[model samples]
Structure formats: C-alpha cells, structure tokens
Target chain A: MTADQTAAWAEQAIAEAAHEPGSAHPSREEQVLLRIERARRRRPKVREERITLAHGAGGKATRTLIDAVFVDAFRNPALEPLGDGAVLDVNGGRLVFTTDSYVVSPLFFPGGDIGDLAVNGTVNDLAVCGARPLYLSAGFILEEGFPVADLRRITASMAAAAAHAGVTIVTGDTKVVQRGRGDGCYVTTSGVGVLEREITLGEPMVRPGDAVIVSGPIGEHGITIMIARGELDIEADLASDTAALHDIVATLLDAVPVRMLRDATRGGVATVLNEVAQAAQVSVVIEEPAIPVRPVVTGACELLGLDPLYVACEGRFVAVVDGDHADAAVAALRGHPLGEGAAVVGVVEADPAGLVLLKTAFGGTRIVDVLVGDPLPRIC
Target chain B: MLASQIRELCEPGRQYTFMEVCGGHTHTIYKHGLEDYLPEAVTLVHGPGCPVCVIPMGRVDDAIDLARRPGVIMTSFGDMMRVPGGQGSFLDAKAAGADIRMVYSPLDALKIARMNPDRTVVFMAIGFETTAPSTAMTVLRAAAEGLSNFFVFCNHVTIIPAIKAILDSPDQRLDGFIGPGHVSTVIGCRPYEFIAREYGKPLVCAGFEPLDILQSIHMLLRQLADGRADVENQYTRVVPWDGNRTALDVISRVMEVRPFFEWRGLGFISQSALRMREAYAAYDAEVLFDVPGVRVADPKACQCGEVLKGVLKPWECKVFGTACTPETPIGTCMVSSEGACAAYYNFGRFTRSRHKETSRT
Candidate 1:
C-alpha cells in the first residue's frame, strides 16, 4: 500500500479505538494497536539508522541523538536538564563537573592549538555555571606513527593554559591506536569546580526585561579554523579567539546579579539564545547593529555563505542580567582583556515565548532559529 | 528613498506581481526583511533559481549509486550532502563506509584525484551557469595535466529555459522580473531580452544587496508606470551587457547542451541543462559508469511545482510548515538554504502575521 493509504488506515483504526467506552476495555487486537500507537508517540527515537557528521555537530540532530540514546538510557535527576555541566551537592557543598573532547583538525591554528582548546573548553563550561574551576583531568589518544615532538609541544601548551586559568591537571590517561585508526591526536578533558557563591544562576532565574550581553566579537574561532584548513583560496587576516573566561566571568558576577551565563562555543550565540528562550519561556529580540562582529570576520562569513551569528566562539560568552544593571555588567566585562569588546546585544520580552527574533537594519524583524546541520565542519 | 519612489509609482486597486528569478535575491529579500519596506500593492514571487532545490531525486539517487562503487571517492559541495535522495543523502552514505567527501570547489576534487592515483574521484557537480565555468575550467585543467581518474557527474542547468517555462505556464500572472545577478554576470543581459520582447515583461538584472533589490524594484515600477517593457541592468558595476567573453568561451568549449534534463519541480525542458562534450567524454561520469537513469515522481502532498510556477505562495502549500521544514524536508524546496521554502521558514513566516496586523490597523 502507498504511504497515504497506510496513514488513512491508521487514522481509521485510531478513531475506532477512541470510540470505545472508557470503562469498557477494548479487545486484544485493539489494545495492542493502541499501545503501539502510544509507545510510538511517547518514545524518543533517532530516526537515522547510522550516525553522520551532523550527529556530532551541536545542533538539532545532536540534541535528538543525545536525548534518545544516551539520556534515555542514563536518565537521572542530575542529567535531566542536560546543561553544559551538572551541579552536585555533596554534604552541603556545591560542585560543578563538565567534560569536552577536542577533535579539531590540523592540531594547530592561528591563535591557539587543540591542547589549549581542550583545557579552556572544559574550564569555561564549569565557569559558566557559577563555579571556580580548580582541577582538570586530561586523556590523550595517539596514533602509532605520531611524533613525540608534537606531543611535547601540545602538552606544554596545555600546561601553560591550565596555569593561566588557575587550574591543575591532576590526572590523565594515554592510549595508542593503529596509524590510520586515529587522527594524529585527540584530547578529552574533564573539569571539577566548587560553587561558593551565595546566589543561584540558571535559566529558571531568567525573567522578562533582562538584558543580554556578549563578550567580545563573535565568529573569530570558527572562521580562523576554517581558513586554517587551507581548503578555500580566500585570504583573510584572522585568528582564533580561544581563551579562558573564568576571570572575566567572575568579574561580571561580582559586579552585577547575573541570571545566567553561557559560553558561545559550539552552535554559536543563536543556539544558546534558543535554549535560553525555550527554558525561560520568554522571547529574545536582538538588534542586528548591536551585535559586535569584526569587519574581517563578516567579510569571510559573507564570502563563505555563512552567518556570523551562527558561527562558534571559544572565549566569548553571553550573559543575562537585570535590565537596570546592564550597563554595569558591560562596564565590568570591558575592564577585562578577554571582554574588552563586550556590549549589550538584546533584551528579553514577555510575548512570543520560546523564540529569538532579530530586528534587521531595514526596520524589519525575522526569526533566528538554532543551527540545523553542520555548516562549518568540526572546529572544536 | 527607493521605497518612497516605489510607493509613488504604485497604482491604486491593482497589484503588481514581480518575480525575482535568482535564489540569491530571494535570500536577500527575506534576510533583510525588504517586504516591510515595500508598498502592499507590490508583491515579490520566488523563481525556480536555486540549483540545489531544482535537482531531481533520481539524479541524487544516481550520485549515491556511484558513490557506493568500490575504489570510488565521491565529492560534492557541502550543501549537497544533506539533500535527501530516494533512499538517503551523501552524509548517510558516508556513515555507511562510503568515501564521500565535501569540497569547497571542483579543483579540490581534482586534487584528491591527483593524490590518490589508484582511486576514481567523481565530483557530483550541481549549480547554474555561474558555477559551470569553474567546473569547466577544472575539467580543462585535468585534461591538460593528463589526469585519467577524475570525472564530473554534470548536473549544471541554465536559467533561461526555466524562466521561459514559468512564463509559458498559464497559471502565472507575473508583470516583471528581477533577473539573476550572478548568472547575468556570465550569460549577460541579452539572454533575458526574449522575456521583454516575447512576453512584454520588463526585466531588471539586480545585485544581491538590499539597496540593489530596492533600486531594481523601483526601476521595474518606473517601467510599468511608463508602459514600457524592456530589459534593463541595475547591477552594471558587476554585470556587463555582453557578459565575460573568456568564461563563456571556456564553458562552450568544454560543455554542450543536453536534449532534456529533469528538474525537481519544473520537470524536463529541452536543451535546459549541460553535459560534457564528446571530446571530453573520458572525464564524464555518465560515459564511464552505468548509471540507473530512472525518473522518480515528486511526493504526493508536496506542492513545490505550484510554488515554483508562482501559482501558490510558499506558506500556501499544504504541508509547508507542518510536515515540510528545514529540519525534516519532504520536498526539495525545503532542503537548500537558498530555496524559497527554507527562506520563508527561516525568516519570512513572521511577516505574514505582521502583514495581517498592518492590514487590520
């Protein structure tokens, strides 16, 4: 039968099943069909048979894959929210833990390398959760024919990055695979931090009239990596904006009452805004000219058919604070080197909940949705 | 200023329907929300210009079949990877152990062929006249370098035939056209003269900027107000009257017009697509491989044909936002970013409600 025919048959069966009295139980065959239909609606399923690069991209496919496969099997209270990290309470002490893996190709780029990226990535993940990142663990996967000199250089950079972030590598693991089995190197880092603040920071705390501020210009890291691949012939003077944001984040927290903080890493600021809007049940309307983007980055993005709003940023973050304290937050962030280019980009609204709208320069508004597929492949 | 001028030329109690015959113009219109600046009397219709959106499913299936062959490395643009075929996409094929790579240009595909001398590198080429010159140049380079393993699965199409087909359709009520910017840079302003001479519709070749589009609309409105139907150029800074002679020469030397080719919504049009010339047969994948050139029908519920013909708005489609979306596309219209359905879904849906509110006010 055709798809339409099957759908019609299913609709008839569902209608017949619904007509039965509530107190009167249905027959065996009808019960089986009802149960199958209920299960099909309730269960989360990843429809793709095999995994693709989009599954690894921090987009819709990634969210579906994680929720259907990993979260369903490992369902727990701590893992339910599925934020950047998990906040644990141990004997009245608050702790935040997060992990990230770095599979960026070429190993090194303009401003930073994979080693520093792995350390800063996990550190920022913990820092954004209102924690003081203290300890981290590193794991390395090396190919059989990999060079020791390159490994030493990477480790040295990782050590310097950890020292700068005021964190220590307390533990590590190493494994070797066949020459072709692995990319030259892959590093995974896990971080643990203690939350000593007397205030709470989360999406639930967000409310209407909150101000949205972003630290520095966006799309530097993703664009730098894309250029470093040397695939396209276009030339631009750019570099990755990869840095540890714990100090700057602490400064903002000390200055203003921040409702939430999210590092615009994978999926960029647009994805983070969507998550915030959905979680807080509010609308986010941003002004196009207010968003800080470098001229060079904008040029590269236009040439590559990419939007700078959706490109990834490693060091930058978005913060939600009270509307009155928005100026203070930007002032506090601008005092730091990593956030010298911070500005207020948008505001939260009550109507049209769970959506992000961009007010164009031409006095028109449009929706800004989350990233759907891998436009720029594997930067972090 | 252009918006005010366009408003000054608007006729009362009459609607002017103009089609933007380029995907880039469609993207610019929605991205910058140009509709809000225009008078309600003027309407802009999307044309069948998105190359990725016009490719038939059967051709995608054929590309996938070629990728599945042993010792074959298939390469294509990144946007083409997610476009669903009859079975699956290139991304799905790659996950199933097929060596399908995404390259930014055809020269990169040729580079892969040079690096791996033992493997056959097939570049699934898809685009319109703007991109055909690069593919033709790459093919010429491969021949000059004596690279025997490189092949091109040509799917490049022309815009003139598709525009003619839209004009020939009885349901269309178009008044003017916004000629394609990039395609006009290659094929020039003369190719679009037939639209003005034969159909009495004014055509303006416009750039891909918000202001460029506004100026083009203003020009079209002026022509309509003066009762003049002529081909004009608003993007003279980029597009020449006769086009690039060197690029046109290269394209003609390497490629030839096919008898007919299948478009996703527009169907088959005679001499509408390009194929490798007999002299370059060795570099053509169609000549080297046994492709199952089977024709597949569009899905039952999809109204992309009507949408392409300008008879139905993107939002007027039955399954437009409900079942067909950028995330889960049931038709080719929702697959590409430049596609009309995707542009509407991404940026223009809210405009409908805004328009309603404005009308009520």
Candidate 2:
C-alpha cells in the first residue's frame, strides 16, 4: 500500500477496534500509527485556566507550566535544555548556575531540617552537571511573628551544610510576609560551580545500551517528611537521606564515562527516568528488583497507595553510564559513603523510543510514565 | 512458579474468564504485570470496585458546592481531589480560593475542625467497606469529643451489592471471581458466599501481592475445573473467615444503608451505599448544608458503563486514548489512579505484543 493508503487503513482499523466489543487489541501497525498520532498531539502546553498546586509539583504539570510559561517567555539557547543547572561560557571558563526554593512544611523533620536541605539541594544540582560547587546565595521569606530563635537555628544549619559541601554563602536576601501569608519560613538558594572536567555529559550523550544507576535507596526523604506530618498514624524508624551528592558524583565521573546525571528530588527516580527517555529519544527498561528501596518506605507507600518509584528522594541522583563500564561505575560509587547503596537499575533501549518501562518481578513489563500531579504535597 | 502451575491448569481450547471485583486487584494486575503470566485462554475482567471512579458526577458537584461555601474547609482523600464534576474538581475549587484540603484520613478533618474553632470542616468520605469503618470511627470520635464544627459528607459504599449488580447484568460473561482483598479483610469471606451460591461462580479472596493474585486465580480455576463452586480465601494471613467484627459493629452504629445510591457507570443499586445515622444528623453535611442532590447523566461518547460491566474493554471506549486521557479526563474511569481505564492507558497499552512474544519464549 502507498504511504497515504497505509495511514488511512491504520485509522480505519483503529476506529473499528474501538467500536467492536471485546476487540480491544490493535494490530502492530495500527499501534504504531496511534502512537505517532498521540505524539503529534501531545506537544506540552499550559491548558489549565488557572494554576493549581499541580503546577508546583515536579511532575508533568510542573514541566508543562515551565515549558509553556517560563521557557517560552525566556527562550534562550542555554535555558532550552532545562537541566537542573545552566552551563554558561564565561570568558574561557565554563560555569554552571542553578537555583532552588524550599517550601517544605513543618520546617523540621527526622534526619535534616529545611536549612540543610536548602544548601544540599542546590549543591547537588550543580554537582550532577560535573561542576565543582563553589559559591551559593541564600534567600529567605519569613512570616510575621516568626521566632528569631528559630531563624537563627535555621541559618546556623545552612552555614554548617554549606561548609561541609565546601561552598561559601556569598550573598543573601530576607523578606517577611504577614503571619498568615507565609508558612513559618521559605528558603531559596542559588549556587554557582566551575566545570573542572573536560568530559561533556547530558541527555543527548546518552545512547542505547547505557546503564541507569541510582545513588542509593529511594523515597527516604519524602517518606520521612510524610511520617513526620503525623497524619496517617504510620510509625516507621526512618530518616531523610538528605546529604550532598557532589563528592559521590565526582567519584563516579572520575571512574567511568558518564552520559547524564539528575538528582531525584521532588518527583523521584521515575520522573528523572521519564525526562531522560524523552530527551534522549530512547527507551529505558528497568528491573523492579534492581531498584533499591527501603522496606519502611515501601510499607509507607503501600499504606498510602503511592508508588515508591514516584516518591521523592533529596539525596539520591540517577546516573546514565556506559554499558561496558557499568560495573566499574557502580564500584566507584559504592566506595563513597553517600553512594554505598548504589546499583545498576536499568538499561537504555533503542526501539520504542522515548518511554520508560519497568520489568516487574513477576516477569511482566509496564510503562512508568511521568507523574501527573503532586501525590505527596510539599514533600521536598 | 504459580505462573507455570496456572499455565498447566489451562485446558487446550477451553476459555476461562474471571472477574476481579476490586479496583485494588486491577491495580495489582497492571502494577505487577500479572497479565504476562496468564495463559492466552484465561482473561481477567475489571469490576466496579473503585469508590472514586463509581461516584456520580452530581455527587462531585455537591461536594464542590460545599467546598465553595464561605467559612468552610472541604477535606477529601487525595484521589478525589482531581475528579471533575459538572463545574470542576476539588483542585479547581482550591485554585479558585476555596479552602479544600486533602487529608490522609477522616480523623484529620476532625483535627482541622478542632484547630479552627470558628470554621466548619467537611470531610468528603469515600471508599468501600475497607475505608467505611475508619470514617465510622472518626464520626464516633467527633461525637465523643463534641466537635460541633466537624461534619462528614459520607459517600462510603458496600461491596456486596455492587458485586451482585455486576453478576445480574445481562452482559456479564465470567466463569469465576477474584474478590477484593482489602474489602474482604473487613467484610470477610462470608459476604462473598452469595456469588458462589446464587451465581454459581467460584470466588477466591485475593491479596495485593503479585503471587497472591496469581494464587487466587489458580484456586478459582481449580474450583471451576473440579465442577464445584465455593468461596475461598487466598489472603488468609490478613483476612479472617468472618471478617473484623468490631469494624462491622462500628459501621452499623454510626451509619446505615441508603435505599439507593448513584454509581457513575453502574447507576443506582438498592442498599448499596451508606449515610450518617439519624443519631448523628448534627454531624452530617448533607443534613446541615444546602446540597443540590441532582442526577447528571454520563456523557454520550464515554462508554464507562460498558467498561465497568466487563461488556467492553477500556480501549473499546470511544474516547479511551484520544479525546479522553489521564490529563484531560472526561469520565471518572480516567480520573482515579486505580480506575481500569487509567490503568490501561498508563501501563497496559503498547505491551500486548511484547507480552505475547515473551510468553512464547
């Protein structure tokens, strides 16, 4: 059949399949045609009349809001990729710059508070881009009647975290809103880092057969914050895995050829995988048993009817490495304290491009699509 | 191991169809990729068990109306927040400056009511028998604490009547049943005996684990193979034979069955839903608030009713993946995470051919 005739035939077959009772399965050619049609229609746009909380979630809605609103308005070459940080060519030296804001509820949690989170989150963002995090700018939005003592404690923790990560807090700004306008305090941190490595890495660098490795057990920070809310009556002996990943990331880069890196913060590893798949135009197939998750986190997820794959992790990052050097990359990551639980979770595939599939322990495969909304609100 | 056993039990050219009457089972089936292991002759049909999916649009409109009221905080499970009504959803209401909160439990709404003494808090309670007891306990707790500002917009439903409705539907073609795991934990094995007795369909109460579902399917197939229909329990570790007596008592105390309630796709079933008891009228949102209890018809293009009844597959729906999707859902089946349509769209599409190839190998 001619190209136009084939397309017409595929559309007719799909229509017939939809109308026919019990004839749900489409032919392979028809499936391909439908997928192409879906892809053509799914160009990201902000369709919501008003911004909902989903716009703030680090998922599909957030991406759409950013792409449709922010990215479209500030269309520049450097900002197009929308990586955690922007790599700018400053004179002869390359520099990575990124900013993150923390609106975590409760202000305090099990392993770390919002103070340290503000510092580590930004440092890790720059670090994932193969940059040596150098300086940070801290900003605070405090509510009226907020205790000065609490402010002092938070700043002190941020200072300690910055020192540990070998970054200096060079500048800062503080603003106070009315009592009901703000939730105690909100912190925003922007970091600048120098690219010391000569190697280039990004989603475009990722190829088929690349190995996907996670730094550690996922969903700890998000689950810790959820339990600390004291709403669900679930008690688990767990703490947030909120440490900076610069050192572990540096070690991994030194040992092997790294294709891409992303810190699994707000939307966890699943969101990161989807981003990689879409950007690289490749499929990712991960084994369920290979993705490491704490039992407590799994229990919490099951009780709340949440997927562990989509739960956020503050200290964890997903890395795409050369398939031939996957083992060496894992060993190098394991030598560091922060990457002790690192393991090869999945591999990149050439066919069925731009999707992430999970091979379940039961030997079945299912698509792990991008998250639609904020399942766990204010979990970062 | 269970997959091979299930495959071996399948007789050549003999078809076996089983209905999993719970949304949780449907979720597990897709989540764990259980369909890959099942033989080609066996088919698992999704039933009308998702509370969020089964809720009618008119009820959602009423909840949104309650949320829009001044000085009122509408609370609901996160699953119900995005479900759209005639006007919009709780998320849309929240975006429009209505005080809508997503709480993990009904007790959290009571806590919110207590914290804000001047404001009224209304919990949009939803779910099957598994979650009704918790709402019942929360209501009793509110009564004990004398929380006058707290009220419940109870939409809790029972599982047995819905199951019976599915069985009585003329188009239902099933040989056995996979009972809901969590609901069975509360209502127990005794409630499902009616299916085996009246419908002559074998049922096995299954758990949520991959193996648990596989084992339940195996047990149901065995019962069918033996020419004996009986209700069995594969989740014996959690589900008791008679069910949780205290929870059943609590449900009876604070709530009573309504004569009929509207399901999104299944229409209204007799004594299928629960409401606040007369003694707890003061804490009932429906009694206290001005709710427009109107019925809204389902959209013409959406075939969720046939999908709910297993008469049509989710993909058979006219708007399954094109006009209706998880992002822009025109039907309830595409809104809830566990809904059959959402499950198929999110995970099941594009894997049928691959699954067949792997099974053959």
> Top model by DockQ, which number?
2
**For each candidate, what is chain B's TM-score?**
0.97, 0.98
Total clashing pairs in model 2:
0
Model 2's CAPRI class is acceptable
Point out where model 2 deviates above 4 Å: A1-33, A36-41, A376-380, B355-361
Score candidate 2 by lDDT: 0.85
> Could you tell me every candidate's TM-score relative to the true structure?
0.92, 0.92
How do the residues A86-181 of candidate 2 rate in per-residue lDDT, one tens digit apiece? 999999999999999999987989999999999999999999999999999999999999999999999999999999999999999999999899
Clash totals in order: 0, 0
Candidates' lDDT values, in order? 0.85, 0.85
Residue-level lDDT tens digits of model 1 in A1-380: 11211123223323443443341333433343233224323334466788888888787678778889999899999888887889999899999999999999889999999999999999999999989999999999999999999999999999999999999999999999998999999999999999999878878888999999999999999999989998877778998999999999999999999999999988899989988887898888888899999999999887778888889999999999999999999999999999899999999987566667788877677778776677732100
